[model samples]
Target: MEPIKKAYGYVTRTHKGRPQVLVFQHPILEAGIQIPKGTVEEGESPEAAVVREMIEETGLTEWGKPVFIADDRWKADDGSIHHRHFYRLDQKDVPDQWQHAPSGGGEEEGLQFTLFWISSPGDIPLARGHGDYLPDVLEERPEDGLGCLEPSEDVKQVYLIEEGVERIIGETREQISFEEGGTVLVREQTLTSEEIGDRRTVTRLMASTNRPLTVEDSGGGGMRAVYAGDHVIIERDGGEKRVPLHHLPVDTFSVELLLRTLPLEGTYALSFHAFNVLKGEEQLIEIHADEQPDGSFKAKVRFGAMIQWYWVNTETRELLKQSSDPAPGLKMEFRR
Candidate 1:
């Protein structure tokens, strides 16, 4: 049979003085751990194919040029011959780990992969001989300051919050869906309790590495946002307004939602301007994270004089508990 051309990538970086290689694992346990690789398309050079495969399979939006490494030919179990080109690309400034349902056709269309870095690929092993060429291309890397913390991969979370004699129940789900344009990452959350006025449901959607395209809060004055060009078109209280969102000088009003996705390190801090959807006014918000002695993490989500503590698991990134005393004599708690 004629040979099928393919390209494979060894996306490498440094975290805390250790050399690391990027890899992924399919949700289906049998697929095993893997590196970003794919079949080269007709008329496409292997170099171009390498980058395209890395982006599509690994969900990386930003990357540098790839350096050609080596080549090999192998016969598949199906008796088809395959020619593979391997390349190495350096990566920078990204979260420790993230999840994405690759954008493409074929058996990968709906499969989600948990993408992360490992100091050694052989330790965990990549399925289907995906690591065959690792010994030829692996190299020590200089520190990139990417930090060592990795968010857990769990997509479904449930939490219970309490205050004084009152309680609030919250549940969140994270997933990817094939939409009109392509794959859209979605986070849906619901909040309810015996509290008289605290029933809320929020849905957030993001395209690629882009900021949120929509943030719908059914409880907070019916606040909603739609991405339009470089600005966010917000609809509320029978009126609409637009606000600018940028890439650099990164700023976000969706701090609470972002915490679920950001990799939490021993120390994390960011200050940005945010629109108070409930107040209909712009305000400054600050969020900080620090590792606890128990290996879990806590983030201070403060708004005005009220501060809430978000506790998350170190390895799983699961929300273990959250508590806040918003007012005198009132303590609120949420436990998973």
Candidate 2:
């Protein structure tokens, strides 16, 4: 029995606004079944081999980073078992250019490939003989309890919006702070609120100096103003009557300290933990910046109806830090 080797590939494409998944396709000896897989070469590193195999099959060249997902072992037809390491490749866009030309590597004669769009992990049909490892691979990472590891320090920033105003807040290394509202120049404008009970109420607020501010009512309750910058925004709401930008009573202490400091760009995980305060609930926050971008970074966050802040560099669109208090029962913890 010959020991079968391992390999890897990703289900990817250049289509925008789609999630990518990793997969490999190979013809099985029996009939009608093709195995998508990650293959391991004799001398190449597992990571490098997957990249090479992906390029050969998909003709894509812009794989950004590979995250190790899991590993599996299975018995082959020849009475031998092989262990294959798997990874999920993170990429925003597939490259436009790809070459079908093989770089002249091992086992080149027996390879064939294609790309797939996996809507979910369940879409991938598993081989009957292989033990189920997809569950472990697709398991969501714990949002809390994950300690900062890679780049050591991290900064989380958020933008809270109400009416036509936006306030930036930051959380770094467990310390929460606020950016100076005075330094954030805004253009003054007036707009009439939607007609309410025979009264057309009007309100005045500041708009972003760099970009147009979008104004919309926060449902029927209040107003939400959003300023879309390169990668950040300033928002304000009149209904909350909190005056987040010009004056934030809860965040006043850290305004001076935050404005004086410059935040570095990096990969960070921001965790918002809600604690019950006397009047209501407050947030205990933490930020982990493990990787840095040259000038800008992007992150997608979901909130449970709580206000958040973002500290964005005026020139680079890079997110410096974000801070927020979770709403009632929505608290998160991360573990690494």
Candidate 3:
């Protein structure tokens, strides 16, 4: 089915250690408060359309990076297909209350919207379920440490150690060591069925930097890798090759390293290697996080068709559980 292309931005900010979302209501229309969203123009990308909508609706010129959250095609009242792309952005400078007369020549050109900040966007009255993803976005954000955590020199830092056993057509033991701003290490030993009868392998990754370094030691075969600027340098079978970073998924091992380096607040772009090796390309993964009611934080990582959601504890900042798309995907939980 053919679908109309549309884009929207869920803009947010932090005031007094709490994350607040931006919602607006029209002066005349008795509709639910909605976000900045609109249709994509000819030859324009969804990413570009979202930013343009945000500026037109809110009159705000500065914002953090935008993370693409959800996109799908749904049927409208006319039975027409509408393909929508949603993104989340964080801005810290917007006032608590303001009025904006949409500046673009669009459906909302002359419409004036009264904007307000809400700590819990779910609690507010919205128009046509426009804020439906508030719960999901809020659930994904980290509760403590503002947003992404930064290394603190004054406070005493603690490391979290977790161990678990996982089965994926086979059984394997996993151990993860996470430090606030230090190196994160993940080690795994696996035995799985493949073309070569039974395969046993031990893999390790040092994901301390934006560029992750990985090494695998097999009984006979070994592989080594390093992520440089915009490319991944891999060594295997005594041969080396450089692959663009966008083609790889960065959260292959875990999200601990990504969390350590994320900006405290605002939109940001990140890169990671895919959990599984295929053909990798360098691309920017837009991401956002928010605190939950239970004091835990959640993060959303997007890499094209691959989406990773992480639930982390508030005290230890350790991963609690992870869910992802794609069959045979990585699903894990941390037990006390």
- Candidate order (TM-score): 1, 3, 2
lDDT of every model, 2 decimals: 0.62, 0.36, 0.57
Error of 3 at 166 (Å): 22
Per-residue lDDT tens digits for candidate 3, residues 1-336, read: 567998878888887987777888877676567877889999999888999889988999986667655454444577776677767788876689999899887566677899887777547777653664565355443333222433321111111222333433322334444332233344444433342233333333333222244545453465655443234556678877766544323534334445644552333345544533333344345456776777676778775566767665646545566555344433433232
TM agreement with the true structure for every prediction: 0.44, 0.34, 0.44
lDDT of 1 at 71: 52
- By lDDT, who's the top model here? 1
What does candidate 2's lDDT look like per residue over 254-311, in tens digits? Answer: 2212222224345656544322111123344443333325444333333334344444
Q: 118-194 in candidate 1: lDDT tens per residue?
A: 77645687877677645434543222211121222223323333343553344433322323323234445544444
Better of 1 and 3 by lDDT: 1
Least well predicted 10-residue stretch by lDDT in candidate 1: 142-151
